[model samples]
Target: MKYQVMHDSGPRLRVRAGQWAFTKEEGYGLASLLLDQDFIHDVFTSYRNGSILIYYDGEVENKQRIFDILDGITIDDLFEAEPTQTQVSKEITDDFYWNISGMIGRRLLGKWFLPMPIRNAITLYRAIKYIWNGLDSLTSFRVDVALLDGAAVTGALLQGQYDPASSMMFLLSISDELEHYTVQKAKSTLKDSLALNIDTVWLVDDDGEEKQVPAMDIDKGDRIKVRMGDVVPVDGKVVDGEGMVNEASMTGEPLAVHKTNGKTVHAGTVMEEGNIVVEVYSMNKETRLNKIIDLIENSEDLKAETQGKAERLADSIVPYSFLATALTYLITRNASKALSVLMVDFSCAIKLTTPLSVISAMREASDNRMMVKGGKFLEHYANADTIVFDKTGTLTNATPKVVDVIPMSRRYKRDEILRMAACIEEHFAHSIATSIVNQAAEEGLKHDEDHSEVEYIVAHGIVTEYDGKRAVIGSRHFLFDDEKIKLTKTQEKKIEKEATEHSVVYLAIDGKLEGLICIDDPVREEAKYVIEELKSLGIENVIMLTGDGESGAKAGAKSLGITQYRSQVLPEDKSRIVEELKAEGKTVIMVGDGINDSPALAAADVSVSMKHSSDIAREVADISLLSDDLYDLVTLRKLSVGMLDKINTNYRNILVFNGSLLVLGVMGLIQPATSSMLHNLSTMIFGAMSTKSVLSDRDISNDIEVEAIQVADAS
Candidate 1:
C-alpha cells in the first residue's frame, strides 16, 4: 500500500494513494482498519480520489507508526476488512442523495420532453399503486392516509386535471423516498450505537504466554484467552480449558452454558467461570454477535407510547377526512373543493413526523454515547416519576477501593488476611473482589494460588478451602445466617463502630469470624447533581436500592440527598419493589449494572446500565451508557422530554397549517392545485423539522454547569 502525504497539520493528516486506488468496499474497509489504530481518532477514505484524511493523536512516534502501518498494508488486508459506522453512514447518505436526484431528474425530463398524453399515461400508471393500496385498506375495513391520497389523485384524473394529478403523484413519490431514507439512515446510526465495542483482548502466543493486544490485531486462528467475568472478544471454538459461557446476549437465556474443548463460543458472551483459550475463527463484522446486533436494529421501530397513539389517531382521522370531503361536495356542489379537502388529510404528517422525531432523538442519544434500544424506552424514561438506583456501580465509583482490613483472629495478621482474601477473590471479577486484589498489590503482597477450587455464590460470597480449612467471604447474611459463622458480641460491636459507613465484606474460617474488610465505594462526583437535575425534570421519587449494609446504604443516600432507601435488599426484593411502585401508579426507571440487577431491570418501565457493567447487565438493560458518566442520565431525560415536546409541536403545526389549507380551498380562496401543493409541501417541511436535533447544540455538561451556577446565584 503505497501512499503520499498530501497535507499534515497538527493531528490532521491527509494523503492520496492515486486515482482508483481501491473500490468503495475497499475504501470502507480501509477506513475501518485505520480507525482501529490506537493513535487514530477518526478516518475518512475516498476511493474516487484515492484520498484518506486521518485525525489522530498528535505524537511523533504515533505519526511514524501510522506510516509504518500504511506501508505494511496489502490488498489481502482490504479483502478481509469490514465497513465501519462512518462507512455505513456514508453509503446510506450517498444512496439517498442519488435517489432524490434521480427522482427529480426523471420528473423534470418527462415534463420537458415527453408528450402530454405520455405524461398523463405515466401519471395514471403510478396512480394505480396508490389506488390499489387504498382499496386494500378499505377491503381490510381500514381507512388511512393512503385512501385519502388515492382519492385526491383519482378525483383530479376524473376531472381531466392531468397536470394536478401528475404533481400529486410526484409529491407522493418524494414522500415515500424521504420516509425510506429517514428510516434506513436511522437504523444505520443505531446499529453503530449498539455495536459491542471490544477495545483489546488477551492473546495467547505460540509458547502459551498471554499478552494484552488490540482486538483488531487478532487474525484467523489467533488464540485469545477469556477468563471468568470477561466478555469473549471473538467468535471461536474453545481449543483448551472450559467455562460457563453466558449466551444471554445471543439467545436471551438467563442460564450460562458450559463450554469445554472443541465447543464453539461467540463474541459478546461472558465467561461466568473457569478460563478458556479460544482459537479465533471470526471477529468484528463477521462474528455471530453482529447478527444479534442486526436483530436489535430491526427492533428500532418499537414505537413510543405517544408515537403509537399519534399513528392510531392518524388512521382514525381518515374517516373524518372522507366525511369532510363528502360534506364539502354536497354543500358547495364542487368536485374541486371536495378534492382539496381530500388532499390535506392529517394522517400523512402525523405518521411521518412522529417517527422521524423519535428516530432522530434516538440518533442524538447515540451521538452522545448512549444506546437507547428503542423509542418506547426513551418515552418511558421521560414519563417515569420514580427512579430506582443500584448503589454500587450506578451511584458510586465503579472501581471501589479497599479502605481497611481487620483481622479478628490473632492467628493471622492484617496483611495475612488481606493476602488470603486476595488469593481467593482474584478468581472472580466483581468490583469488591477487584478492590481486595488491588489492595494486596498496593501493600506489596503477592497472593499466590493457595486455595482449592473456589465457588462464587452470586450476590453472596465466595467459598473455598484454604490449608484444609473451610474459608468463606461475603455479605453478613451470607456468613452469619447462611454459613452459620458466629461472631462474638465484642467483634460485632467493633465492626459496627469501625465500618459503619463503608460496605463490609465478612470473612470466616471454619465457621468462625476471622476478619472484616471495609470497601469504600464513594458516590460519583456528579451523582447528587444528576439527582437534582432529575428532580427539576419532574421526577417525584428518587430511591436507592442496594444489598449493602443499612449504615452504608444510609450514608450513600444521605450523600446523594436521596430521602428513601432500602438496604440489605435481595434481587427478587428489588423487582418486587419496582412492581409495588408500579402498583402505586408510579412509572419506574431502574438503573443498575450487575447480574443481581437483571430481574429488577426487566421489571422496571425503563432500565439503564452503565459502561464497564457486567455483560449480562448490559444485555438486559433497556439503555446502556457507553461513557462512564452519571450525568448522561440527566442528558437522557432532557432528550426524552424534548422528543415528546417536539412531537406535540409537530402535531399541532400539522393540524393547524393543513386545516387552514382545507378551509381556504373550501371557501374558494385557493385553487385545488395550490391546496395540494401547500399540503404536501407543509408535510415535507414538518417531516424535515422532525429530524432536527431535539437537544440544543450546546454540550450537556457545560449547560448543566451553567444552569447550576445560575440556580446557586438565584438562591
Candidate 2:
C-alpha cells in the first residue's frame, strides 16, 4: 500500500494511491482503519480517484506515524462489516430471551413439589432484595415510586401472603421489560426511516466517459451522470444537461422541479425526467436522518417544561403516599390496608408517560421529513406567537432566473456580458451567483476562465481582473457607491425601465458601466397558503425581512398578504429585529436559508432551516425541513401543539384514575393485591398509548380548512 501526497496544508492531508486506492469495500475498510487511530480526527475517501483526505489533531511529527500505518495496511487486514439492524436486533432479542427464561424458571420452581422450607427461603431472598432497595431510597432522602413498590412487596411477604408478593414482583419485572422494548422499537423505526440504500451509481470521468461504480466509490469533484428513475448519490452542482428532479426525500414536495445546468442538486433526490451530469461537492455529507437520531438520543436534557413539571409533581407525591400508608395502619390497625395504600402509587405513571409522548412526537416529525433537535424546540414552536422569515430561499424560490440582460455599451452583447459574468460567478455558491451562471449555460454561452483570482465581498459583489482589465459584478451600492462608477442619465432611465419588479445585478469593466442582469425571484407556490395556515394556528405576528429594496419587499408582501415587512436589512439588522421582537415578549420562530441568516436564526426562540440552506444557517437552526416547502412549518406547529395537548390529557387521566384507586385502597374497598394489579395495568396501557402517532388525516384536513376560513374572513 504505497501513497503519494496530493496535498498538505497544516493539519489536513490529501493522499492518493495510483489507481488502486478506493473500492466500495476497501474505502469503508480504510475509513474504519483510520478512524481507529488516535491521531486522526476525520477521514474521507474517494473511490473514483483512490484519494483520501485526512484531518488530524496532532503536530507535524504525527504525519510520519499516519504514513507508516497506511504503508503497513494489507488487503487481508481490512475489517469486515455487518448490517447495523442485524446487530441491534440480535442484542435486544438475546437480552429479552434471557429475561423471559428467568421469569419462566421462577414460575416453574414455585409450581414444582419443593420442600416448604426451601420454597420459603427462595421467597425470603427475593423479598429481602426489594426491602433493601426501599431502605436505600429512604436513606438517600428520596421518596420515589421504587420505595413504595418495594415496601408493598416486603409487607406482603412479612404478613405470610407469598402469592401476593410474588405476583407484585412478577408484574414489576414485566413492566420494566415492556418499557425497554417500547423504546428500542421506537429507535429502530427512526433509524429505518433515515437509512440511505444507495448501492451503485453512473460515474463520468474527465474524458466524458461514463461507467457504473459503487456509490461509496464516488468522490468529491467527480462527475456523476444520472438518468430518469435514478436517485442522485451526492450533493453537487449540475454542470451539463437538464432534468425534472423529484426531491420528495429532501423537500417533501410531490412535484418534480425543473433542474438544469448550474442548479444545485442534493443526495437522495430522484431524477424523474431527462439526464444530468453533476459535479459532486460533498461526498458522504451527514444525512438529516442521522442528525435527527442524534437529537432524539440526546434529548433527555432538552425536556419541555411540562415534562419537568410532571416529574417534579411525581416526586412531590411520594411523601404523601408514605404518610397515607402510615395513617392507614394507625387507624385500621391492619397491615393489608396500609399495604394497599402503598401499592397504588401515582408517581410511576406520571414520570413514564410524559417523556414517551415527547419521543413519539419526535419520531412522527422525522416521518414527515422534519428534524426537531429536542423536545424543548417543539415546546417553543407551539408557543411561538410571531414567525419571521428570510425573504430569499425561504418564502421565495431560491433559484431566481435571468429575465432581462441589459448591456450599456454597444461593444458588448447581452450574451457576451452574461458569459463573462457567469465565468466569474461560477467560483461562488450564492443563489444570485448560481442564477447568473445557470442562465448563461442555458443560452450555450461558454467562456473560459480569463480572469485573475476573484475577490468576494460578503453581501456586496465580486471583484476580479479579466483580460488585463478591472471587472466588477454586484449590487448598485458596490458598483456606483463603492467603486464610484457613474451612471449616465440615459443609462439610469434604461436601468429603471428594465428593473421593474426584478432584482438587478450591475456589471462594470475597466471603470466603465458594462450592463445589468435582471433576475426574477418568484414567491414559492405554497408560501401564501402556509402563512394563512400559521394564522389559523394562532401565530399573531407574521413578518418578512429582506436585503432587497423597499419597493421589492412591498410587492412581495402585498402578493403574500403579509402586512409587516422590513426592507434593506443587513445580516446584523435581522438579528436586531429578532431581539426587538423578543423584548416585546414574543416567542419568535425564525425561518431562513443562507449564511447571512445564521445570526437571526440563533437569536430566535426556535429556528428552522430549509433543505437547501447554507451550512452555517442549518448548523444554527433547531429544526431542519428536508424540503423547500413552507407548508411543513404549519405541519410542525400542529404536531407540537398536539404533543402538548396529548401530554396534558395523559396527566389529567393519570391523576383522576390513579387518585380514585388510592382513595378506594385507603377506604379498604379494594384488596391490596387487586389495587396493585389494577394500577400497574393502567400504567402499562397508557404508556403504550403515549407512543401513538400525533398526526391524523382528519386533523390535517380540519386544520387546513380552519386556516382557509380565517384567511377568507380577514380578506
Candidate 3:
C-alpha cells in the first residue's frame, strides 16, 4: 500500500513499498482525486519509466493520475521501458509465511485462550520451540538442495540422511502401485553422433587477476570484467566494467546485453558486459544456482507448489497423545480424535522423502556413467514419450574412414593420389577435409611441403597448386556450378559411387574429374539398443534430422531403425521441422549437439542437448545430457514418468492429510507443536515416496533383500 503525508503535518507516514511481486499482480500505491478517479493517473501524465513515486505532483488527482500508469505496467512492459529490471520477483516459499503464522497462533493461544500464567508460559514456550524446529527442518532442506541431483524429492536418500522419516511413506501417499511389466522396448538405439573438439569459446574472467595462480581459485568479491565476444563463466555482479551481453540464454530477450552496475550475470551468457563494473553477487554454488537447477530438472509439476500449505498444516496442529490425528479425523472427524490425527500429519513426508529418493537414484545413475544435474528432471524422465536426435556427432562417430580411393588414371597410385588430396584438404576444416586428413595420417602419408599455397573456399571446393595443375577438389556440384570441370564416364562412375555413399567432395584437375574418395561414418554400436529402448518407453516416432545428403541420412536412419529422415537441412530449418511436428500434435524432445543446432534445440517441446555440444546449444536446451550415451534416455524417460506419478500421488496425499487435519486444527485436541511435527513428517513421507520410482518395482524387487543385508553388513 502507498500513502503520502499532506506536508507531514496530521500524521507521520511510512515510505511506500510495493510488495515484491510481478506487475501481473498489483503494486502498492495511493490514488489522488483529480478526475474523480481512485488511481494515480487522474492528473499527472506518466513518463516511459515505471517508477511512479518521484513523478507524483502536488495535486492529489494529478498524483493519482501519474501513479495510474502503474496499472499499465507489467513485467514484459517494464523490461521494455526500464530494460534493466528483468528480475521478476520470486514469491517467497511457504517456509517464511507459515513460520510467522505459527508464532502468531502461539501468541493468540497464550493471551486469549489460557488463564493460568503457567499454562500461558507453557503455551508460549511451545510456540517458540517450533521456530527452532522449523529451522532444523529448513536446514535439512538446504543440505538436500546442496548435495542433491535429479528429482527434487527422490534423490535425497543416499545416506539415509532423513532416515527417521520413512522413505516409502511418500510412495504410499503419491502413487498407486503399478500392475504391469515390460522388457526391451523400441526398435534399436540410435548411433552416437557427438563430435568432440570443434567449439570456439570467448572466456570472461572476473577478479581480473589471471596471474593469481589458477584464476578460478581466487575468491571474488569485486566486479568482474567481461568484455565483448566473451562467455560469462559465473553469475556475477557488474561491479567494475561492462559491455553489451547477449542475454538470450536466460530471458529469451533479443537485445544487446546492456551494462549497468548491480545487475546479475548468468553463466553461459555472452558479454555483449557493456561499459560498467558490477560486483560479484554469487559464484558457482550460490547465486541463482538453485533456480537454474530447478529450470533444468523440474518438468512442470502443478502440485509441488503446495509446499506452503504443508508448512501451515505443520504449524496448526496441537500436541496429542499416542493416536495419529490425521488418520483419526479421516476415519472419524471428532474434535479430539481429529486433533490427535492432525498431530500425526507431519508434512515432512512431503519435504524430505521425494528429494532424497531422487538423490539416491541419481547417484545410482552416476554409478552407471550418467550425471544428472538435478533430481526434478529424473522424476519427470518417465513421462517424456518423444525423443529427437541430432545427426552429426550424436548418432554417428565423428570420424569417418576412407574405404575406396580410386584414381582416374593409373598414372597416379592410391598413396600419391591421397597425398595430393590430403594436401589440398589440409587447408580446409570441413568434415570431409578432416576425414581425408585423418585417413591420410592413418595410411602414414607424410605431408608434402610442395602443396604450401592452398586456399579454402567456404561452402565450396579447396583450390591448391599441387604439382602445378591448378587442382580444384570439392563437391561435383561445386565443379558443375563453377561450369569449369567436366567428368569423363570413368571418373563420373567413380564420382557417382562416392557421392552415393554420402562422401563429400569431388577431385578435379585441369578442368577434368581426376578421381573420387568414399568416406563412411559408421553408426555407434549402442544406437540399436537405445532406439529400441526408447520405442518401448513409448516414443511414437523415431526420426533422423541431418544436413547429410538424403542417401547418407536414409542409410543412417535405416541402419539405426529410424523411419523418417530430413536431410540437407540448414540450422534454422531444424527447428522448423520440430514446429511442423508440433503442429501435427507431437510433443517433441529434440536431442542435438552442435553450435548450429541451438535454435532447433530451443524449438523442441523438450530439448535434450549433449553436454559436449556447443555452449549456445546447451544453454538453450531444456535437458543437457552430459554424455554421448543414447541409452541414457531410457534412464531419463523411466525416471521422469516415475517422478510425475510420484508428484501426482504426493499431491493427493497432501490433500488427504490436510483434508483430515484441518478439522483437527480447528479443535482443541490439535495444537501447534504436535501439528508442526506431523506436518513436517507428512512432507518427509511424501518426499521419500516421490523418489522411490527412480527404480522400477521389478528392479527394486530383484535386489532388495540381498542388498539390504549387504548394506547392513557394511554399516
Candidate 4:
C-alpha cells in the first residue's frame, strides 16, 4: 500500500491511501480495514479526495505501529473483506432515486413515443393486473381503493378513451413508487440510529499486560480491560479491578451497576467510571443491541389506531364509490359522467398520507434523541393528560453530591469516617455510593481494603468487617430497625438537623452508630421549564412519586412547581398509583430510570425511560430518551401533537379537493381524464408533503435549549 500522512495530531491522523481512494469501493475497503484495527477508535474515509482519517487511543509510542500495519495491507485485502450492514443499507437507499427516475423515463417513453396500438396494448396489459386485484378484493368480500382505481380505468377503456385510461394507469404506478420510497427511507434512518460500531478491545495477556486486539479474535476465558466510556465488547465476568458499568443498553436502567471481581457484565454496556478486567464468557454472538434493532425493524404491529382506521375507512368507501358511479350513470345516461365519479375516490390519498405523516414524525423524534417504539405510543403520549415521574432519576439529576458528613464516633475523625466510607462505598454502584466515593477522592482520602468481604443487601445497605469488627452502611431504617444499632439522643438530634431535607446514608461499626453522610440531589436544570411547557401543551395533572422521604420529595416538587407528589412510595405503590389514575379514565405517562420504576412504566398508558434508565425500565418503556435532557420530552410532545394535526389536515384537504373534482366531472365541466389526473396528482402532492418535518423552526428553537437545537439540526 502507498500513502502519505496528510495531517497528524494526538490520537488522530489523516492520510492519502492512494489515487485508487478516489473510487468509493477503494475508500470503503480502506475504512473497513482501519476500523477493524484494535488501536483505532474511529475511521472516516473520503472518496472524493482519496484520503482516510483515523482516530486512536493507544500510547503515543505505538503511533508508528499504525503506519507499519497499513504498509503490509494492499487493495486486495479489501476485496476479501465482508461488507458491513450499514454500508449495504446506505447503498440501497442511495439507489432509490435512480430506480425511480428510470421508471418515470420508461413510462414517459411508452406513453408519448411508442405507436398508438403498441401503447394501447401495453396500457391494457397493466390495467388487467389492477382489474384482477379489484376482482380478488370483491371475491374476498372486501371493498377497497384498488376496486375504485380499476373501475375508473375500465370505464375509460370501454368508452374508447385510450389516453385517459393510459394516464390513470401511469399515475397509479407513480403512487406505488412513492409509497415504497417513503418506507425504505424511514427504515434506513432507523437502522443507522441503532447501529453499534465496536470493533476492537484491550485484551489482557497471561503476563497481566493489556494488549489491543480485534474484538472478533477474543474467545471464551480471555480477559479484557474495559475503561470508563468504553462499550463492553463481550459478555464476561469481572476478574480484577472494579468500576460502575452502565447496563442501560441491555437493562434499561439509567444508573451504572457496580462491577467487581466475579460480577457479570454484558456486551454493548459502557463503563461509566473506573476500570475493570473481565474474563469473557461469550463473544461474537447475538447481543441485546441486535434484539432492539430487530424490534425496530419488525414494528408494523405497533401502528396507531388512526392508521388502522384510515385503512379501514378507505376500504369502506369503495362500496359508496361504486354506488355513486351507478347513480351518476342513471341520472345522466352518460359513461363519462359515471367514470368521473369513480375517478375521484378519497381512499388513496387518505391511506397513503396517514402512515407517511406518522413515520416522518417518528424519524423527526429520533433526530432529537427520542426513540419511539411505534406510532401508537406517539399518539398515546400526545393524548396523555396526567404524567407520573419517578423523583430520583427523572425529576432530579441522577448524580448526587455529598453535602455534609456528620461524624458521631469519638474514636474516629471526620476524614477517617470519610476514608472508611469511600473504601466500602467504592464496592457498590449506586448514586449514594458514587457520591461518597467521589467526595473522598476529591479530598485526597486514600485507604487500603481495611475491610473484609463486603456483602450487599438490596434496598437495605452494605455490610463488611473492619479490623475484625462488624461494619455497616445503609439507610436509617436498615441500621436502626434491621441492624438494631442504637443512636444517642444527641446523635439523633444532630441527624434530624443535618439530614432533614436531604437523603442520608448511615454508617455503624460493631452495632454502634458512627457517622451519617448527607447527600443533595439537585433538580435538573430544565426540569421546571419542561414541566411548565407540558402544562401549556395541555397536560392536566403533573405528579411525582418517590421512595424518598416527604421533605425531600416535597422540596423537589415545589422547586419544579409541581403541586401533587406522594412521598415514601414503594415500587409497587408507584404502579398502583398509575393504575388508580388510569382507573379514573386518565391517560397517564410514567417517566422513570430504575428497576423500581419498571412495573409503573409498564402500567402507564405510555412510558418514557431516560438514557441512563435500568434495563428492565427501558424494556418496559414505550419511548427512550437518548440524552439526559427533559427538553426532549417537550420536543416529543410537540412532535406527536404536530403529527395528529398533520393527519387531520390531510383528511380535510382530501375530502374538499376530491369532492369538488367529483362534482365538476358530473356537471360536464371537467372531462373524466382531467378528473383522474387531478385526483392522483393531488394524492402525490399530499404524500410528498407528509414527508416534511412536523416540527416548525419556531417550535424547535423556542422550546428546546440551544445545544439540543444544534444536535437536532445536525442530525
Candidate 3 error regions (>4 Å): 1-123, 126-381, 406-417, 424-433, 448-494, 507-515, 611-616, 652-680, 691-693, 696-715
Could you give me the TM-score of model 3 versus the true structure?
0.52
- Top-lDDT candidate index: 1
Instruction: Give the whole-model CA lDDT for all candidates, comma-separated.
Output: 0.86, 0.80, 0.52, 0.81
Error of 1 at 404 (Å): 3.6
Instruction: Estimate the lDDT of model 2.
Output: 0.80
Q: Which sequence of candidate numbers ranks them by TM-score, best first?
A: 1, 4, 2, 3
The sequence of per-residue lDDT tens digits that candidate 2 reaches over residues 445-537 is 999989998877656789999989999999887788899998999998887677757778899999999988988789886788789879999
Q: What are the candidates' C-alpha RMSDs?
A: 4.1, 14.5, 20.5, 6.6
| Candidate that beats the other on lDDT, 1 or 3, i.e. the better one | 1
Residue pairs in clash, model 2: 250-626, 251-627
Q: Give the TM-score of each candidate.
A: 0.86, 0.70, 0.52, 0.80
**Evaluation by TM-score, superior candidate among 2 and 3:** 2
Model 1: per-residue lDDT, tens digit, 441-516? 9999996677799988778899999988999999998998889988889997899889888889998888888888
- Give the C-alpha miss distance for residue 286 in model 3, angstroms: 14
Alpha-carbon shift of residue 131 in model 4 (angstroms):
2.3
Candidate 3 lDDT, tens digit per residue, 82-164? 11011111111122344446655764565577666565345333333333544565666532211111111221122222221
- lDDT (Cα, 0-100) at 666 in candidate 1: 94
Model 2 scores a TM of 0.70
Task: Judge candidate 1 against the unseen true structure and give its global Cα lDDT, from 0 to 1.
Answer: 0.86
Question: For model 4, what is the C-alpha lDDT against the true structure?
Answer: 0.81
